[model samples]
Target: MSEQHTYRVIVRGVWDGLSEDSRARLLAEVDDHGLTAMTFSEEGSLTYDRALKHFSWRFTVVSDAADGDEMAAAIAEDRAASALAALGHGFRDLRSTVTDLDTMKINYKGGRR
Candidate 1:
């Protein structure tokens, strides 16, 4: 069996050509999409504000070690776009970045070794 790695994908984009009704509805429910609700999960979570100028979606994706980070990022970007479309939201300038937890290195400060 092959090993699997967990990747944290962050997809960012800007709202594009939102209708008046869509903007109003988003503003009304803005509180629910605030920074406080931001988290990384398989299903993804979105963070935005009243301005709605920009938004970010956080996704925790798992990939086979051989598939690597690029594939995971692509998957995340697709998932984010799909989720947004499902909610009837329009966005542009979509971009995604990914971090592979399995290969990440952390430096410990002055603490118990």
Candidate 2:
């Protein structure tokens, strides 16, 4: 059986060509999308600052592909785009970075390696 890996993907992009109404709506909902609400979730968590110049989406994905990291990143980026579109938001320079949790080494609190 192929092994599955859990990945945390962060998709980042800049807001582009947002209408005044959309901008106002986002600003009004800032409390819900603020840094305090950020999380790595399968459904994705979107976060941005009050400035609204840039934003990021955090997604938790599980994949069994040999290139799970890349695949997870791609999936997260696409999901982010769809979400932005659904909200009538425009984004540019979308990019994603993924971390494979299975291969990640935890640093011990003690001196143990």
Which candidate comes out best when scored by lDDT?
1
> How much lDDT does candidate 2 score?
0.91
Give the per-residue lDDT of model 1 (tens digit) for 1-113: 78999999999999998888789988998999898888999999888998889999999999898999889989999998898888788899989889999999998788776
- Pairs with steric clashes in candidate 2: none
Candidate 1 TM-score, C-alpha based: 0.91
Q: Give each model's clash number.
A: 0, 0
Query: Clashing pairs in model 1?
Result: none
- Report the backbone clash tally of model 2: 0
Clashes of 1: 0
Alpha-carbon RMSD of each model: 1.8, 2.3
lDDT (0 to 1) per candidate: 0.91, 0.91
Question: Per-residue lDDT for 29 in model 2?
Answer: 92
